[model samples]
Target: MTEIQDRPAAPLATATFESLSPITGDVVGIHPVHTAEEVEAAVARARDAATWWAGLSYDARATHLSTWKGVITRRLAQLADLMHQETGKPHGDAMLEAALAIDHLAWAGGHAEKVLKRRRVPSGLLMANQAASVEYRPLGVVGVIGPWNYPVFTPMGSIGYALAAGNAVVFKPSEYTPGVGEWLARTFQETVGRPVLQVVTGFGDTGAALCRAGVDKVAFTGSTATGKRVMAACAENLVPVIIEAGGKDAVIVDADADLEAAADATLWGACSNAGQTCAGVERVYVHDRVYDQFMSVLTEKARDLHADASPGSQMGPITMPRQMDVIRSHIQDALDRGGRAVVGGLDAVGERFVQPTILVDVPEDSLAVQEETFGPTVTVARVRDMEEAIARTNATRYGLGSTVFSKSRGMEIAERIRSGMTAINGIISFAAIPSLPFGGVGDSGFGRIHGPDGLREFTYAKAIARQRFKPAMALTSFGRTAKADQQLATIMTMLHGRGTTIPKD
Candidate 1:
């Protein structure tokens, strides 16, 4: 085993933890339980590495990132397999997740220079004599707390972008998938020949340590409850944080939607990766005219899907065993509230897997509809029209991602839904697009981690205004006269004294 160098000296107890394969509950790897002091040391080393990284020219950084990207792309299968073993996701789903992450890496590397380089800004009439420009500078070091579900893809959203923006990253992956995180760091080290990216493995205490380790910024992805805790920890140091939290995402079906296509997308969105996705479709609203037909098609499609570790399975076991109880509770609550399970019910949630479950006529206030089940379950509800559909979709405290299926009103309805990203006639397609930003609002958490905004998230804007010529009125100087002040006041009034009005009124 190639141990990560610079690990803090072990204490007397020398505690450790094991990463277990969710599929078989076998030990995948054993790692030390890094303490707060160790996490702080890692960040301190990252601070030094960040200086060297940020000092490199944009082309130099891009070249290095490109090399790392090529290494990951060529060995995509190897990484995907690790993702599968750690998260218990199907191999094909792991591949898709890794591929999307690779694409984002490429985009972040190729566009960092263009996005962060200094550029001139309009000085406006107030500062016309000054030449003003703004550029993004890398924050010294960034701390990343990753989620187990979609381990590789989710963390890379922050890691890749942060590196592209010229910052070193210290990542603390979820305990359930520490092996995957270690593999990433090892590969990155091999490609870059430096500790520009490092991993510290442990549980929640390790994550909280990273937040308080004096990093310039922290990017966290997990549940909303955990996100709040992460934010509170970061608050101790007044460190900035970008939180990608949980969501109760929905899919809205319009009367004019392609019923077949909508049903297919809804089933896949709700059951893919065993529906552990934070932005997965948990609640679906269909127009009353097509509700029955859509439900029939969805139920039939879901019936064909199964969650298991067996070969060629459509889904896999829940990465976290505790989530099984949550899934069962939601199903039971829905049933107790007079809802009927169209496909699978409470029994669908087995020891490690949650089968495809579709509930109908679930009350709007039911936990199945109001909370994130984080399992392969969805509640189908009827709406009188698109108006009600939009209203119901926006009723949740979480606004992460949503989907819409309509022929003419797809974009229109999507616009009305309050979410960070909305896919029309597609399922979670925005995540694969490199130019579009990904994040959420309200309880889903705030801050983006992809696209140009993602690059800037790990950086601070530095603005410079040089005096190109002396102003006619030296308003800012002690030499300014009362006459000049009067003239400036008159100009200000002339520019903004009048408010425009409608002629007809």
Candidate 2:
């Protein structure tokens, strides 16, 4: 039996919080700080809904998800505008994010039946008389705690897959992006004609309540420190969890690489979304042979980029205002520690936006290099070779996404990086592929949130073995004679008498 947390009775709620726009600090929307009791009630409702939803055939569930996909795709612009207002990202970026999420939804719905359906398996020689099979069953209800960055694409990694696997979901969006969460649930309800997906919005306490709300599984995407807390909360109920946490991702530029393309991809990966991306490039290690040329190109391209909440802005304001201080501290620490800023530095961080800041010659131990400076800032370091580049890149506690820009050895170098996803000759493109599983290792969190692994993450595997015929050798019954036991031993010896030896590759 699974152990449950000792949850205290939640008091009635009379409090509320407002989602403010990060750009102008204007109120985007108001929502309640749902109590533990309210969250559990929502879970209870989801549990009931899950039974009916799970009872449907995979094709039936796929149909519903497809319908929801159409609804979201049709209103892509509307949702993107809402996302822009709440998160302060450019409309085009928001649309791209939403479109990618929609694509994932389609993939999850279209492939779930083939991926999760029961299938037969060989029973092996020892159990030749039995027929074996396995199938993945829904875990009933799932709780997702989403991050503010890439609000749509990130959370849907779990949400879309969980629903396609036949579980009802209750999502808790970040305090800064609750409206986006509400809009998603509302649209899903509109298409499905049921509250299969629900939203609970508020601050940290509200999210904590969701953690203790007795859901079967929890999918959390946020900072590493918060991921630890979420893991602890989920431990109370022995519930399974998937955490997509912080990253200090790096980009490697080999001597033989396309220097211009490498610099362009790295800059975009680092500065796009105001550098709020978890998988965004925060570090770059270039081979010493071409370090000078790479830096020259990177600096020139970065100088042309800017962050603003106004129209025509390629980058927008930081979604979370508190992040400004963190970004400023990192830049200041880097500069004070003998690092050189080629483009923007301490002055780049403003009231709401952080301009593209490029730091070069920063110590590997510097906070800007080690920690997740989730603003549009990146630290570039020189390395002697690809070996040193891989070593330096893997030295961080984070093991999320990484990039390699080598014409011949991109995949070879990427394979050596201790990260979950690696982009070859590109930047953060793994998230765009719906078939790829996305997550991280070590401090970056565990379990996956996309593809077949994601569909299975919110489910339990049920295995069955049926006896097809009676075996000639009866090993389980007392009716077995001494001669029968001897014969069985003789047969076992005949099959395993050979000594074990290592095979030469």
Candidate 3:
């Protein structure tokens, strides 16, 4: 008999913790801290479920996903409550994040059939007698390790796309936000009537277990240092990985930019979610012409923002405790290097929450400029021109995402910046468009999680060719003629055999 995947309530408490509110340090909820063995079990079940799920046609998979999306949409408020309790983010922010995730889910489900279905290709005159086609096949099971920042929107970049591509998912959310992960899996099971998606909650070790649990691929969203470790762990099983790592992304404002819009976008990009975003704007480079105006607007906006554990606060506590130290160090480094804190100063970092901070005149080599602070801190630097802004923005090893605010040269300057997605006249808005690929290069990691790239990431390309007829002069058999050989040479000469551009002897 096939055993059902639903677990008994008795074993739920094997891992327990007090999820605290970042603002008040009070227990919000108690969640399970799953073990490595538990994570392996979840993967094992997901692997079994994937066999059944992947066997369905692309259209059938789409229908199943649509049903799941409906469930998510209807019960979004309930899910958002759990997100709020776990991460201490504002309820509205959680809802916005969930809404965006649902949008991606809907897009992924509706489009996966078209993107992944087999398609025919031209065989060329040389192979006219043969039929050729390419199709994408599922990789069975995918393991996802999520981050606490933007919990729903970020991991869904992998989870939704993977499900749409017809692969089962085993997710291990960050230790700081396990309840949200559990809620998602629970709702998925209730709606789909299967364990196509499952959660294994724990800290880093549990996540590591999921990587080595014989899954075909691992999609990780976290710091760059942790991303490297995740890649190394997956390497043990030869598992493919897509890492969405840390970013020191910058916003470049040209002399022709609308200073008001640029300042607003820059402030939100650096302060939203307490600047816990992976692709959030950490630095701003404005042309000297409007530097003063931008700075004034930014500080005024920063002053109005507040970080508290309260439900209505615009910002929340740093989800991870250790990150507070990193935030403090960045502020201290900026201060020690003669940078002036235009708004919140060194005391901005609290036990769990970090207040909005704006610094100016920081040296280019300071930690605040070079490293990812991952907090609500922005270093505003004045650039001589757009060229200097582009150069300074590209100087970071991390190139996850960026923003540009220029009237005429927006796209031109944006394309020059070394990042994955660039938002013009906005901030981090490209991630909402399902057609654009999301991921980064260099230290920010490779492989995408949304769009067609996301659908293809969970699948491998399969090519098929079949001979339809025998050629007049068979090239592979012993029936070839001299005339055919001469014709082939003529074809080669007409193509790649022409005189080299370098003039070959």
Candidate 4:
């Protein structure tokens, strides 16, 4: 999913990469392609800063994070403009992404104390003389390797929560959107007066180096293949990592569902960001009773929308250039496998943009259905019943996000799907809530981000056991007498004798 890749470092002080605008193929900016040495240096600085940052009280940290959030909120349009240039998503979409991320930042800062602060626990009868307590402690420095699609929102799910939990972060943004990463670091530096949030720009080497640079944890967002590599790199140090990778998210429509509402949500979820969303709807399983009506409404609305760089276009160009080939290939394969294009077909995929494409009768084994297209295309299939729909939805190896649209059985069906999160009657609503965790199971990758889970991801649990008084049993002392042993046997027998099983021949 990333455009830039690993290359040998130049002999100069620093090598660099050009960020290209998907709309015009023009160079938007040039950023340094940091080497392994530079990544290590950044981690060293972050490790030092983490000590000072973690020393501050939770309320103090919240205040500072709020200031940075205010800065981002005030300059939302500016960040959105950069996002549109690098990612080529619509201005409004870019704004919305950054806005949601900012809200998460605010929530992380405001709720860290309540979610992470130490608390007391009851001691058991045998250990009544002991007091037990537990709290989450910060893991020094965190490395974040962000994805190009939804660059701001995706990485901030890690960066924001990690900081709120009292850790310094070193972010390695996707080579495609390095400027946005630098902008965030620059602003945080000005507001917080430290390098608590820093940026390292480069390609795959930069990210791989970040993982080996001795950070406490690494949070990554991208393809499932790349996620495995990240896991391997961190294995040497046993560094805990959270991977927010791609998904072939599906939507299930029951016989009792609202066809019009379902169609509108499906189209938006599929084509909104030109289908680069990691959790965008890629497959639909509709009950046979409402299949025709749902398809009729979906295709009609899809026809009215288009992808282009032209002003006021609802959809924007594909951010990564190579992804266009993948998009087109999927469409062609679906058509070759006896799928009917009820809407735009292969002709819909252009050099930089892809119009909405809806396929009917697509085989479940086809690439368009089995893999992550990451394009503005969807496959619709008719199911015999709601049970069949649920089975088909859970068939994919990816289990990230899913949608269930049913008036009476929405919750029931949603819970049945094997995904990290599900939207009962909405599209991607779990991501916006900030309290529900976002992630995947199986091939979609592991670990979670967002909510209390996210705040705790960059931390480790520390437990405390305090002895309040001497135990009457003196179990650990060699001075125990025969009477003590008899008493212990009596206590055990009294507790479990009635439940013991006996066999008499």
Question: Per model, how many backbone clashes are there?
Answer: 0, 0, 2, 0
TM-score of 2: 0.95
Give the per-residue lDDT of model 4 (tens digit) for 336-397: 99999999998898888888999999999999999999999999999999899988898989
Instruction: Put down candidate 3 lDDT per residue, 237-286, tens digits, no spaces.
Output: 79999988889999999989888888889888898888888888899999
**Compared with the true structure, what per-residue lDDT tens digits does model 1 show for residues 1-505?**
0011112334547689777887899988888889999999999999999999999998899899889888888999999888888888989999999999999999999999999999998887777899999999999899998888888999999999999999999999888888889988998999888789999988777888899999999999988777888889999989999999889999999998999999999988889988989889999999999998998888888888888779799899888877777889999999998999989998888888888999988899999988899998999999999999999999999999999999998988988889999999999999999888999999898999999999999999999999999999999889989999999989877766775632230
lDDT against the true structure, each candidate: 0.89, 0.88, 0.85, 0.90
RMSD of each: 4.2, 3.8, 5.2, 3.4
TM-score of 3: 0.93
| lDDT leader | 4
Measured by TM-score, how close is model 1 to the native structure? 0.96
In model 2, what is the error at residue 212, expressed in angstroms?
1.5
lDDT of 2 by residue, 204-312 (tens): 7777888899899999998888788888888998988898888999999999999999999999999888888999999999999999999999999998888876699
Model 1 scores worst on lDDT over the 10 consecutive residues at 1-10
Extract clashing residue pairs from model 4: none
Order of quality (lDDT)? 4, 1, 2, 3
